[model samples]
Target: MNSTVTMIVRLLLAIILLVFGANKFFNFIPMEAPPEGSFMDALIKTGYMMPLIAVSEIIPGFLLLINKWKGLALVWLAPISINIVLFHIAFDISTIAPAALVFTLNTFLIYINWKKFRTLF
Candidate 1:
């Protein structure tokens, strides 16, 4: 991707992360809950899980916005993104679009920053 496009994608994803993360605490944006007895229901049942997810989103979102340790930020978000996608895929087919977008963005970022990760492997 061109630098401008990459920056746009990064910003878009970062803003989404920050907004959703903060929303978890502030409820600024209404979030839909999964139906009862689903996999995500189990996660939501753990009160701390939401806070923890908020931190995860906020930290990596900030990292991406500041253009610092971006590869690490993507790494941090990978599992969270994966889980988000899987949760939607398994429990809520109706609202899988956003989760799919998030996962796609996360993957694109990881691929774009692969050079920084070469040393890890």
Candidate 2:
């Protein structure tokens, strides 16, 4: 990838993650509640799960912003992105657009970092 493009994408994704993840804790970005009986509603009802999930988002978002251990940060965010995609697909179709964006960014990052990952497989 072009270095400039890489940096732009990295910064955009990092900013997005940082804002959303921080919102999870701060509730600064008001969002509608997930539908009743939906998976998200159930998860939210659990009390403990949301905080952990929020932390997971914050950590990777911070790492990505710093451009440190970005590959590892993307690796950490992978499952979270997948879950976001799946959850939106299954429960809230209206939200899949952002989830798709998240998935795509993570995928693109991983592709560009293929050299770093080649030995893992």
Candidate 3:
């Protein structure tokens, strides 16, 4: 992708990560409770899981926003994005759009930066 498109995607992903990540801690954006006995409910019940996820998101978000260690940031976000998509697909299909966006953006970033990551193989 061109630099402008890459930057836009990075910024969009960063904003999304920051907002949703902060929400996990502050609950500033109201959301419906997860369904009973669902995987989401189980995750919330763990107490630490949500905060951990918040940190995972926020750190990479800042990295992406600042255009620092972006390859690493995208790598760090990959699994979280996958889990987000999988969770939505399995538990709550109605809210899958954001998850899909995250996954797509992360995947695209990773693809464009594949050269930086090739040495790891």
Candidate 4:
């Protein structure tokens, strides 16, 4: 892929992730109570812990958007993607589509920037 396209993709990914992450912190998206006995319900049952999860989402999202911490942002992306994918898989497969797309795009972004992450080896 062209470098310009790669950069654009990265920027878009960063924007989307950052906005969504901020939503978790800001509750720009209203929270609905999970259904009784649902996996989400179980998660909510953990109480204050829920906000911590939201923080995890928000922080990485912010990092990605800044673009200065691309490597750290990518590191954070893995767990966030896994959580989103699993949440959809276990709770609501229908909603998984967007998460899947994000995951796919993030994977591509990571691959395109793999050189920056090479120091981890």
Candidate 5:
């Protein structure tokens, strides 16, 4: 893709990540309580792990926005995507669509930045 298109995609992804991450930290978006006995409920039950997850999301979101650490951001973001996908899948497929989309986007980003990723190996 052209630099312009790449830049736009990157910006869009960064904005989405940052917003979602901040929501995790601040609950800026109202979230319905997960159903009892749900996977999300299990996640919530993990003391302190929630904030760490929030930080993981927020940190990479900020880094992606800066655009200088695209590779590093993707490295951080990949597992996040995986976790999200798994969480959603384990919980309910419908609830996981967003995570799937984000995962797909991350996969594309990784593919697009393959050169940078390859150099690290």
Candidate 6:
């Protein structure tokens, strides 16, 4: 990938993750109500689940923003991104754009950093 494109994508994804991750903790961003009795509703009801995910997103997001351990950050983000897309797809297709963005950005980052992860395979 072109260095400029990679940098742009990285920054875009980092900002997205950091903002949303922080929102999970701070309520700085208002969210729409989850569908009744949906998986998202269950996660919110569990109390810890949302914060847990916040930390999960925040850490890797911070790492990505700082350009540190980017490969590891991308790896950590993969599952979260996948679940985000999956949940949006299953419960709320209308809200799928952000989730898809997260998944696509993580995938692109991983593709660019494949050499770092090749040893794991």
Top lDDT hit:
3
Worst 10 contiguous positions by lDDT, candidate 6? 29-38
Candidate 3 lDDT trough over 10 residues, lowest sum: 32-41
Q: What lDDT score belongs to each candidate, Candidate 1 first?
A: 0.89, 0.87, 0.95, 0.76, 0.82, 0.93
RMSD of each: 1.7, 1.2, 1.1, 2.2, 1.7, 1.1
TM-score of 3: 0.94
Flag regions of model 5 displaced more than 4 Å.
119-121
Judged by whole-model lDDT over C-alpha atoms, candidate 5 comes out at: 0.82
Candidate order, TM-score descending: 3, 6, 2, 1, 5, 4
The residue-level lDDT of candidate 3 at 63 comes to 100
For model 6 the TM-score comes to 0.94
lDDT of candidate 2 over 1-121, digit per residue (tens): 6989988888878888888887878899889987899777888899978888888888898898899999899999999999999988887788698889888988899899989988878
Name the better of 1 and 6 by TM-score. 6
* TM-score on alpha carbons, each prediction: 0.89, 0.93, 0.94, 0.80, 0.88, 0.94
Q: Mind giving the per-residue lDDT tens digits that candidate 5 earns over 30-100? A: 98988998767888898777788878887887887888788888898998899899977776678787788
Candidate 2: residue 63 Cα off by (Å): 0.6
Between candidates 3 and 4, the TM-score winner: 3
lDDT of 3: 0.95
Candidates 2 and 3, the one with greater TM-score: 3
Off by over 4 Å in 4: 30-32, 119-121
Error of 6 at 1 (Å): 2.3
Instruction: Rank the candidate models, highest lDDT first.
Output: 3, 6, 1, 2, 5, 4
**Cα lDDT for residue 33, candidate 6:** 82
Question: Residue 30 CA error for candidate 5 (Å)?
Answer: 1.5
